[model samples]
Each structure stands twice: as structure tokens, then as C-alpha cells.
Target: MSFKEASKQRGLYLATVARNLRLSPHFVRLTVQGEDLERLPRHGYDQWFRLCLPTGDGPVDLNALPDQFGLAGYLKFKSSGLAQRVAVRNYTVRQHRPEVGEVDIDFVAHGDRGVAGPWAQRAQVGDQLALIDQGRGFSPAGESDFQLLVGDESAQPAILGILRDLPRAAQGLALIEVPEAADAQPVEAPEGFEVRWIDRSQSPARPGQAALAELRGLSLPDPPAVSAYLAGEQALVTGGRRHLVAAGWPKSKIEFVGYWRAGGAT
Candidate 1:
């Protein structure tokens, strides 16, 4: 591989800024574009990146640069630096069009009440964030004839990434849990695969009451490999894994992740 390609293979500290867009009632889209794109590491399916923002920066304007280096420039404002940590949770790269050097991250906009959500709520074109992390690429799909993907809003980005990476012939089910009827939207997936969404958050993540139910009742096809990936609320994820394994999935063929735990997970 060329040096340029090799450099793009590793995560770099993006000292740059990008524009933002409100995507849905619960999601905000941050579009970061700069020369730093030349160094963005290629990561796994559903990988996340660290977005370090200052707690003091006020509202931002999309049409103009914030008279300095954007949020990155806020460091000089108070104590010569801003509060930093790997605080913001992991988010999926919804679209990575390297050809144009633009990547999109959809942040769950929880009515500007969340730390990250509110930050994204007022994000603008001149807003700068120190992106210092990138997840390893999505888990390798099984060489089997089919696959299964499960998750809720938090896990949707990763699930969607995997689906878009699948071959046209891959077959399986992708069961997702969103908020209400309005949150449900058409998604592109392999034609052979079935996509189902359940509105469970109208109340709360019910520990797999809906997903585990549907997954347990399904008839899985036999193939060289049958992989199942379950992500979302912690309790629900655990139950899904147990149910899948009990249904005959080998431990090696299943991947379960707790994207979030109920009862005030930070």
C-alpha cells in the first residue's frame, strides 16, 4: 500500500472542525471535514471515535468560522485548555465517503438534556472537536450462508454499517428497537435479509421482551457459519444472547454487547 493509504489506516488527532445537522427528534448529524481526513484511520464495523469538546464554548454558527479554530480554539479562552476525556460515548460512522473526505456521525439528540446531546444540539460549522479515537473495524461476519443482527437506537449505527457491508446475497434478520412510530424509517439492506423494527422505548428497554421473543421464535437456516450480533440495552442483550445460545447458536458464533444499561447509565 502507498504511504497515503497507510497513513489513512491509523487514527490521527483531528485538529479540525465540521458542520452539524439535526437529523431527527433524537439524532444530530455532525459532518467533519478538513485536511485531517487524510489521516483518519479505517475502523471496524460500528466503531466509535472520541469527540472532545469544551464545556464553556457557547452557541456556534454554521455559516462562519468562530473567529478562531472553532471549538479547538476554545482552549485559549479560560485556563488555556478545555475539559477533556473519552467522555462522549461511542457512535457509529453512518457514512464515510472518503472520496470526498467527509464522514457523518449521527448523535442521539435527547432534547438537549444530555451532555453529549446538548453539545451536539448547538454544534455548528465552526465547532471544533478533538477526535482522537477510532474503533477497530466491525466484527468479521461469519463465512456462513446467513447472518443475524440485533440492536436498538444506540446499536443501530453499527448494525447499519454491517448491513451496508454485506454482499447482495446475504440473508438474515435485523431486528431493531426504536422509540415510536415516527422514529421508524426505511433502511437499505440486502434484499434477501428481513429488517424489522420494534418501538419499545415508548416505555423503556424492557430487557428483551420484544427482541428476545422474536429471535427465539425464528427458524434459523443451517449454513457453514451462522453468526448473530446482539447490541443494545444491557439486560436485553444478555437475554438475547442466552436465548440465541439456547436456541443452538454456538458460543463462538454469537457476539453480544451492552450498548447501554437501564436505570441511569452514564
Candidate 2:
């Protein structure tokens, strides 16, 4: 299904933080667990959700949250006065273990910047939050010879999740950009898939520039037989899409999302 169609089917799940780990200098992983998570669907590739995080020391009003974050639901949430106390943001599921009722989410924590990132950095066991599953974004509906995945640090979890869940025989190339080389994580991609990590710290370019440059330099297969997923910074998403389209790729074969804009709160 398309991302919008997938988002229409939703349910609110309340979970408590079980563990917090600093995976890298800029990455923090939060594992949340609850009985509600048992009902969460395993959509695999780039599965995301709207996360409701408490902004104050006060207890969160879980009942105030909507089952889905559509326009009507967002209006209801804002009218409930919960918007002022809760920060809602979209995040990708890094891992989910239904047997143990746990979901892992990775945040790009850069000190006290951003609502969810800082919250995750200081999140403790028992800290509460709510999630509304919006399903997966990467859907290879048509026949494709190979896949092309590209993103920056913010989209790392999603890209990695896609790689992990891809078929063992799938062949593709993933260009992932990160702030530092240390932020690169180990991937278990198919033998035919090449996962390239672009370290931004090694160059003076912006967050997604290095990856975009790499993308522009690649000799891609026939556009009609290639499925591409581009995400991360706003510039990268739009720029990558434009580049792909100009290179003879059909718009239908490319899936893109701007996870966040540079110089803006995520």
C-alpha cells in the first residue's frame, strides 16, 4: 500500500521505555515495551509511526491521543490542549520483537536539539510515550531488477531496516550519509547489495551533500527496471528526486520523503 493509505489504518499504543542506549556519538536507541505493542503489525521495511512524547514533568494524558494522526485527529489533539504538553514527531522502527513486546527506535541525538532526540537521550525505564503505527513506506510493487536506497543520518534507521528485511537474493546499492564515520552501523544486506557509508565529517559538505554527490556519480541500471527510495534532508529528497527524474527514471518508481529540513526543528 501507499504511505498515505497505510497511515489511514491505525491504532494508538501506549508504551514505556525499557532501555536507552547511546549507539553512537549522534545516535540513541530507545526500546519501549508494553502489552499494547503486542498488537503492533510487523510491516518490516521503513515502517514508521507518529510518536507522542511528554514535554513536561507532568504525567501524559494517554487518552487524549488519537487513534490516527489524520487532520481530524490532529485537530482533536490540539483542541484537547495536549499539543502544548506533548511533542509529536514521525520516527522509523529500527527493530520490533512482538514475542517480547518490544520496539526499538533510533533517534539522531545532537545534544539538546530537537524534541524527540533530547527526550530519548534522557529517557529512563518506565518513561511513558504513545505510538500510532503508520506502516511501511518502501513498497516495491512492480518488477525491478535492483533497488536504490539513499538517505542521511535521520533516515538511517529506516534505510537499515529496509536492508535488513530485504530478500536474501535482492540486489541493490544503498548510499547512507552520516555526520561521523563512527555513526555507521553494521548491516546484514544481501550478498548482491552494496551498502556505502558516506562520512560527512571527512568532507566540508552539508549533511546530505556527500550522498547526493555520490548519487549523481553512480552509473545506474535502466531507469524502468530500478526502484529507488530517497529520504532524509529536504534538499536531498527533492534534489535526488529531480536528479532521478532527469536521468530518465519514472516518478512512480521513486519513493521519497523529506524526514527533516536543515536549520529547522525536527
Candidate 3:
């Protein structure tokens, strides 16, 4: 579904960094707070938002941008000088406490490689930023089925959110790949659900390769209604989904997202 359609609440908001901490060797956690968060809706599963950072040693004028995100809004932003003076990216909502007007975002930090990563690494308290709520991407239909959630570190927060919000009786398997074993964190799910952490340090290539390989080799229970959610590098999502479809899983039952393209920021 489109972001507009999926979002329960939509708007442009200004926020300030409240806290920043290193969550692991590869992840950085930032707590952002703003009164605007009081109006942000929480759908409880895979909720995400668009972020905009000021560009080139100048402060961003968030009010100069469009209130919504779309082709028309994008065109406006593109034609305006704001586009050149702002850096934009997408991120998941790891935690939200609207009562206190705060939201937490987990960023996959790859040193100085990308815009958001580097910015997050140096982010300081009281730094202002912009966000546009895009709502959630994963919302499984009610049915009798075992769920499969898989992705690299970029997808970890979303997968963990899904696990935490899943029904107590839900049965599923979540495979998450990270740069190092230390990047793995606690994930809460049903008693019958299983969560596996795949360390990419064991391999020489990028992160998603290990997860994709595992999915290809895994054997599922017989005759179970399966709902699968896959995200991360483009190839992993495409390849894993292809494997599932080839194994007779219905396309409608699978939610696959390419969270980022390989070799560049996405």
C-alpha cells in the first residue's frame, strides 16, 4: 500500500534529539522528542517515517517543504532550494512514548559511508530534525498460519517491533542478519516463535547474504499456512521471495520489501 494509505496520521513535524547511544557495534540509537509526537499515531507494527537532515552546515527550514510526501510534493521539494539543503532518509520507529512526546529511532551505522549513518554517529542532544509519518508496511491478515520474518540489520527494528506486537499464541520464525554477533539484541515473541541471529562477520560479503542462504536451506513444517515477511538488501528480498514462491507459497501471503539497494544508500 502507498504511504498515504497506510498511515493513520500524516504530517510534517519538527523534533530535537534527546539522547544518542551506541546500541551495538553496528547500530546507534537516538531518542527524539517533540510536542508534535503527541499527534503521531502508533499502529504497533513496523511503523516508519521519513527523516530529513539539514545540509551543508546550515539549518533546515522544515516549514519550506511540503506537508505530505508524494510525486507532487517531491516535485515541489525538488524544485525548491530546500531540496539541496536537506538530506532525506527513511527509518523505523523503534519505540514511541507519546505521553511523554518522544520517539526512538535505531540507525544502522556504517561508519562514515552514508549520510544518515554519519549524521547519527555525531548526532547531539538538542539537534533539530524533520520527520513525516509514513505509518507501517507489515500488517498480516488474520488467518491460521506460521509466520516467517527475515532481514538484515536495517530490518531488525521492524522485525523486533512485529515480534513484540504479535499475538501471544502466534507461531513464527524470525531470522535477522547483522554485522557482528554483538549486534544481536533481545526479541520478544510467542512461546512457539523462534528468532535466529545471523552474523555477517562470518562471511566476507555484505550482510544479507547469510540470511538469504539460510532461508534457502530451511525446511518448514508440513502443510502449515505460512505468512512470510522479508526485507533488507534488494537481492535478499527478491531471492528469498523467489525461493518461497517456488516452494508453492502464495504471493499474496508474502510481504517482501527491499529495504535498501546494495552498494549505496537507499
Candidate 4:
């Protein structure tokens, strides 16, 4: 489903931290559990949600959260005083196990920097939170046969999830940028897909710059037969979209989202 349609979905799923693992120098994997998770839809590719984390010491009033975070709901949530106590962020599902009522989310840990990252780094087992499913965003054109995925660390989980769920015969190229080579994670992409890991530690450019550079130099398939997904840093998403469009990619075949900006909080 499109993100817009997903936003209309109504429900609040409360969960507790089940497991937290340091996947890499910059990545943390958190597994959360809730009986309500079994009822959450599994759309697979790039499935995301609004995570409501209690940041205040006061008792959490998860009931104050709106069913869907539309404009009206957001205003209601803000006026409820819940917004001040809760830190909400959008995150992608790394994996979901309905049988166990658990979902895994990956966070880019930067040593106490940013809201969700620090919280995730120190999150203890049984910690409480709420999630409002926002569904998947990767929708390839029906006639497209080739896929091009580009993103930095912030979009790693989403891009990897998309790669994993792609058809076995899918042909594509994924350009992923990380702080260091060690930050790269193993991905289960189709045999025909090529995954390129760009290390930012070796360069002086910003987070998504290297990936965008690689994207610019690559020789891609016919634009009409290709589906491109660009995300992560704002410049990369907008710049990549502009480049792809200028290179003849059909606007309808490209799906992009700026997960975060380089100089600002997500």
C-alpha cells in the first residue's frame, strides 16, 4: 500500500522491549513484543510506523495517542500534553515474527546523539512504547523490471527489507552508504541484484554524498523499465530524484523519501 493509504490505518499497538543487540558500531537492533503485534499487518518491503516513546518520567498516557496521525490527530495529540512527554519518530521494520508477536527495528546509534538512537542504545528489556503502523512505501511500477535503490545508514533497514522481499528474479542495484565499512550488514538480495557499500569514513563528504555520487556515475537500464527508490538524507532524496528525472526516469516509477536531514534532527 502507498504511505498515504497506510496513514489512514487506525490502531495503537503497545509493546515492550524484548531484546536489544548492537548489530554494528553504528547500528542497534531492538526486538519489541506485544500481543497486539500479531494483529499488525505485514506488508514486508519498507514497512514503517510512528514510534511513540515516553521521554518524561511521568506515567505514560499511551491512550492519548490518536488512532492515526493525520493533521487533526496530530493537533489533538499536541494539545493533550502527550506530545511533550513522548518522543515520536518514524522507523522501518527490520523483521516481524507474528507467531511470537514480535517486531525488530534497527536504529542508527551515534553515541547519545539524536532522540531515538540514544533511547534505543539504552533501552532496557520490558521498556514500554507504542507503534502506529504506517505500512510499506516501496511500490514498483508494474511494467518495470529493474530496480535501483539508494540510501545512507538511516534508510538501511528499509532498503535492506525491500531487497529481501524483492522477487528472486528481480534485477537491481543498491547503493548504500555507511559511516564505515564495518557498519555494513549482510543482506539477502536477489541473485541478479548488486549491492554496493560506500564507506563515508574514507571520504570527507557528508552522509549521503558518496551514494549520490555513485548514483550519478552508474550506467542504468532504460528509464522506462526501471524503478528507483531514493531515501535517507534530504539532499540525496531530492537530488537523486532530480537526477533520475533528468536522466529520463518516469516520475511515476520513482519512490523517494527523505528520512532525515544532515544538519537537523529527524
- RMSD to the true structure for each prediction, in A, is 7.2, 1.3, 1.9, 1.4
Looking at model 3, the pairs that clash are none
- Runs with alpha carbons beyond 4 Å of true place in candidate 2: 141-144
Q: Put down candidate 3 lDDT per residue, 1-266, tens digits, no spaces.
A: 42336333458878999999999999999999999987888877898877988868756678786766766777888899887888788899999999988999999997787788899999999988888877788876455688999999999999999998888888889999999999988877888789999988888576688999999999975433888899888999999999998898888888888888878643
The reply for model 4, stretches above 4 Å from the true place, is none
Question: Roughly what TM-score does model 1 have, to 2 decimal places?
Answer: 0.76
Off by over 4 Å in 3: 1-9, 222-224
lDDT of 2 at 243: 93
- For all predicted structures, in order, the TM-scores are 0.76, 0.96, 0.94, 0.96
User: On residues 239-261, what C-alpha lDDT tens digit does candidate 1 reach at each position?
Assistant: 88887777677876777777666
Error of 3 at 197 (Å): 0.9
lDDT string for model 2 (81-140, tens) is 898889999999899999889999999996787888889999999999999888888985
Cα-based lDDT at residue 182, candidate 3: 96
lDDT of 2: 0.89
**Any idea how many clashes model 1 has?**
9
